[model samples]
Target: MSDARPAREPGRRRLVLWRHGQTSWNVERRFQGKTDIPLDETGVAQAERAARLLAGLRPTALLASPLRRAADTAQALADITGLPVRYDRDLIERDGGAWEGLTSREIRERYPAEHAAWQPPGGETSAQVAKRVGSALERALDELAPTGQLVVASHGAALRLGMSHILGLPEETWERLGGLSNCCWSVITEMRDGGWRLAEHNAGTLPEPVLSDDRPDAGT
Candidate 1:
C-alpha cells in the first residue's frame, strides 16, 4: 500500500511586510526618504534577532529595498534561510527630495504648509508610492506558491503604503494604517474569496507568547 498522504488543496499564501531596522536618522527623527542610510549597531542586532524568528516560519522568498538599510536587514534573513534577496527600487522609501535628512522639527519650521500637508517640495506623493509598491508586491506574490510565504524588507512608509494598497484601502484612509516599528512586521494572507486580508499587524514575535509560565521548553 502506498504510504504517501493524500493530496491537499493549496493553502493561503502569506506576505510578510517588514520594516528595516532603526538608523541614526531614525533616532534623530529625520526624514530618511530615499537616502541610503546604513543601520547602526543596534539596528544590526535587531535584524539578526528578527531574522532568527522569521526563518522559523520557512519563508520561501525574500525581497528588499535596494537601499542599504533595507538591504542589510534582508541579508540577515538570507543568511539564516539561505534564500537570496531580490532588490526592487519600487520598495525604496518615499522620496523626500529636499526634505531628506531634515528633522521633523526642522521641516515644520522651514515649511509649515508642506509639513502640514506632509508633502516634500520635490518628493513623491503617497499615491505614487502606493502604486509602485503595490505593483512590486503583486509580482512577488505571483512568484510565490499558494502555500508559500514571502518576506519583504523595506522602509516604514513604503511597507505601510504598499500594504494599504494591497488591502484596497482608500487613498484618503491610508493614514489610518500606522507605521511599523523597526524590525517589526505585518502579515497578509489571501482569503478564500481571493482578496487579501491583514491577519496580523505590527507583530514583533514569531512564536507568539503565551500567558502562563507553564510553557514547555523551546526545543520541545
Candidate 2:
C-alpha cells in the first residue's frame, strides 16, 4: 500500500521481511501452520530465485518463522546471505481457530459461528495473534541493531500486520492492504529518525508462480 511517508531518500537498516512460498494448503485455500509442510516444487523454484536476488544484498542477520515452509524460504536466502536463521513464534500465521484448515467458503458453511467470532480488528481473544506479530516486530526493531541489512521470514498475515505497524495504520485499514502471495515481499527500510518507509510491496519472484489475480496495488 502507498505508505504516505516521504521516502527517507537514504535510510538506515534496510529491513526486508518476506513471506514464504505456496503450499498444498495455499493451492486448496486452507490455513497452514505448525504442520511442518515443505514448499511445493514451484515454491522451491520461487524461493530459489528470490534467494538469488536477495543474496547480493548481504543481510546482516536473518530471522524466520519456525514453520517448515517459512524456514525453507529462509534457507534459500540464507544459502546466499550466509546468515543464520533464528526461529520465532511471533511470525506464526494467525490461527484460524475452529476453521484452521478450511477455506473461506468452507468456514462459512461449516464453522460460521467461529468464523463470525474471529474478526480482523481483534484476533482470537486470549489467543492474540496480533500481539505475537507486534511483539516480534517490536523485538526485531528493539533487538536487532539498525546497522546493516536485515531480513525476516514470516507469513502473509503477520507480514501484512507488521507492515501495517510500520505504516502506522488503523486496524480498519487491514482490509485495504489485502493478502500477500507466495514468495512475494514488501521491502521496507527503517529510517534513521526512528520511522520507516516502504520500498516495493508484494514483489513476486516466484518461478512457478502462484500469482494472485485479485491483489490490488499498494496505496492509501
Candidate 3:
C-alpha cells in the first residue's frame, strides 16, 4: 500500500502511544522493568508489521524509550518514515525493583503485601511514573507543530500511566484504562480547550471517528 499522510483537522495534533513488541520476558510473564531485554524473533516480526501500518498514518515525529525492546520497535517505523527516533529516559518502563525478573505469581508469593498493593519494593510508584512520562510527552508536544502527528514507542505501563496523567484521570480510576497488547497503540487528540480526548485505545488499525452523544454539536 502507498504510504501517504492522513488528513487531519486544522489546528489539532495527534499523539500515538505505541507499545513495544513482545520479548522473552513477555512470554514468560516475568517483569521486565528496565531490564533492557531485546525483542524475540516474534517481536521483530510484530514490529515490522506494525511499522507498515503506522507508516501509513504518516507520523511527523518519533520518540521512544532507550530500552532495547522499545528502541528496536521504534526503529522499525523510523526506517520506513525516515523520521529520526529520539530516545527519552523518562519514557522507560516502571522500575520493578525487587520484582524484576519475577513472575506475577512469584511476586505475590514472595511479597504478599507489596503485591497486594501493586507496589514493588524500592521501585517507582505509579504516580511517579505518570508524572515523568507525562512531562516528557508535554515537552515533546511543545516542540511539535499544531498539526503534527507524533508517535511514541514505549512500554505498556508507562504509556497507560502517561496517558492517564495527560488526560487527568484520577489514580483510583487509572485501572479503567486497560493495557495495550504488544505492538498495539492508542491515539489521543488535542481538544480546542487545550485538553486531550482519547480517540482510540489498544488499536491495531487506523482510527475512525466514532459517533457519540458527547459530540460537541450533538445537542444542536
Q: Give the TM-scores of the predictions, in the order they appear.
A: 0.88, 0.80, 0.88
* Model 2 lDDT per residue over 1-220, tens place: 9845333333377778788887777777665544456789978887898888777777888889988889999999988867788888778776544555556567567755655654422234313555677668767666565466778888876777777776667776655775567887777777667677888777764323333212123221
Off by over 4 Å in 3: 1-10, 205-220
TM-score of 1: 0.88
Candidates' RMSD to native: 10.5, 6.5, 10.0
Report lDDT (Cα) of residue 184, candidate 2. Answer: 74
Residue 121's lDDT within candidate 1 is 89
Q: What are the per-model numbers of colliding residue pairs? A: 0, 4, 0
Residue-level lDDT of model 3, residues 128-184, one tens digit each, is: 999999989988887878899999999988898899998999988887777777888
Candidate 2: lDDT over CA atoms? 0.68
- Each candidate: what lDDT? 0.82, 0.68, 0.84
Q: Which ten residues in a row have the lowest lDDT in candidate 2?
A: 211-220
Query: Compared with the true structure, what per-residue lDDT tens digits does model 1 show for residues 1-220?
Result: 9965343345699999988887888777788888889999978998999999899889999999999999999999999999999999999998988888888778889988987777788998889989999989987887778898999999887888899899999998787776677888999999886679999888895532211100012111
Output the TM-score of candidate 2.
0.80
Off by over 4 Å in 2: 1-11, 113-127, 205-220
Global fold similarity of model 3 (TM-score): 0.88
Ranking by lDDT: 3, 1, 2
Question: Candidate 3 has which clashing residue pairs, if any?
Answer: none
